[model samples]
Target: MSLRDTFRRDQVFAPLRPGTRPVRPGQLDTGGKHILYMEDITVSFDGFKALNDLTLYIKPGELRCIIGPNGAGKSTLMDVITGKTRPDTGSCFFGQTMDLTRMTETEIATAGIGRKFQKPTVFPEHTALENLELAMAGPKGTWQALLQPVTGQQYDWMAQTLETVGLLAQKDQLAGALSHGQKQWLEIAMVLMQKPRLLLVDEPIAGMTRQEVERTAELLQSLAGEHSVMVVEHDMEFIRSIANTVTVLHQGSVLAEGKMQDVQNDPKVIEVYLGETG
Candidate 1:
């Protein structure tokens, strides 16, 4: 096995060591064009190919959804894009400049990519406002991060973010006190405050109420012009509501890509998701 393959196996099977020292948010500007482009990304785990020559792209201000059956390598693909996992051989680029395959996760995030896992990971003990405050904190372990007070601009950004997420009135409320939907919104808001250029959201409406799902759809739609969003979701209804374009993954490669309606009707996508779920 090659060294890169060994590293991939370690990352998949070994205990993940915690990351150290936070990095700056990457520039949120997508240069008003193609924000992310990937070509021939491949990752193998213990001799199993998780990603197979996958090529994907996102234009600025686009909201794209990815859906796939289990073991389709959906999560692994996200890991590669976000720099959490390195591809055995491929090229990943952000904007027109930085090469993502060469950057660390911290550097990639600093360059303005933000990811949200399925669960809301807010600072439960902190009030809504305080959580945003901490999200805006500079690189951790730095002198300025410890010595610096929240700047007026940061405060302004926090307040605007709270308002944007419809939590301005609940700024002082404990995060744990919020409902499931509210907590989800708060987490998204936290990332928004960083003003990332690309946001990757995973399973956002997994447990949300119908009303909450509707609102969340609207929220993501509103962010379209200012941020490029890539959503991974299992909820077909949610995808139908929000996706402008949809990409289906199966066995670690693009099974289909097009409008949601077109992809939904695809024989390959239907055969995979329908055969299993049916």
Candidate 2:
């Protein structure tokens, strides 16, 4: 089946103003247009099709959620987008320029794509603010990271980020001491400091308390119009809270894509994934 048989590109990208600046070349030239592009992407592991002729698109400043069961190619799709795994066929692009299929993982990150995994990772011994400092020190020489004091401007920048993630009150607290939700926010704050154009987040509220899940939704909502965020999650309730659009995957292909309620009601989705869940 053709990709458009399920969803439309025009619908995927709703317009919003961009929020950050590009720090490096090959950055997305969204111009309030498409931030991500993919078509006919396929990946195989020993004759097992992890992803099969996948085609997807995301718009600038959009918050999109992907819901699918295991083996639906969700993780592999992220791996392909991040340059961790290359597609055996098809193509991927970021913005109007920069072919994503050709760039290295490091180049993908340098070009303003940020990824947050399922588990929150923070510097346990470091304070919330210090943890951000270390995050900002990405790939720098060890000595340089250690010798450099956070400048007043850098601290100011981080302070703003702290407030953004609802960590302003916990800035001086040890990261390890923070609650699970707070740790997730701290990790999110760390990524924002890099001014990424696109953020790929996995199951952000998986282990969060109800309150934290609510707050995380607010945080993600606040990030739109500056950063395009794509969330991969299985929590339907959480997706309902934050998803502007929901895409459902089955057998490495999109089964449905649209509003949360609409996708949830799709018979195909219900049979394959949601039926067993609820």
TM-score of every prediction relative to native: 0.85, 0.89
The lDDT, on a scale of 0 to 1, for candidate 2 is: 0.84
lDDT of 2 at 150: 76
Q: Any runs in candidate 1 off by more than 4 Å, and if so which?
A: 1-33, 141-148, 274-278
For model 1 the TM-score comes to 0.85
Residue-pair clashes per candidate, as listed? 5, 1
TM-score, model 2 to reference: 0.89
Could you tell me which residue pairs clash in candidate 2?
19-226
Off by over 4 Å in 2: 1-27
| lDDT of model 2, residue 157 | 94
Among these predicted structures, which one has the highest lDDT? 2
Find the candidate with the highest TM-score and give its number. 2
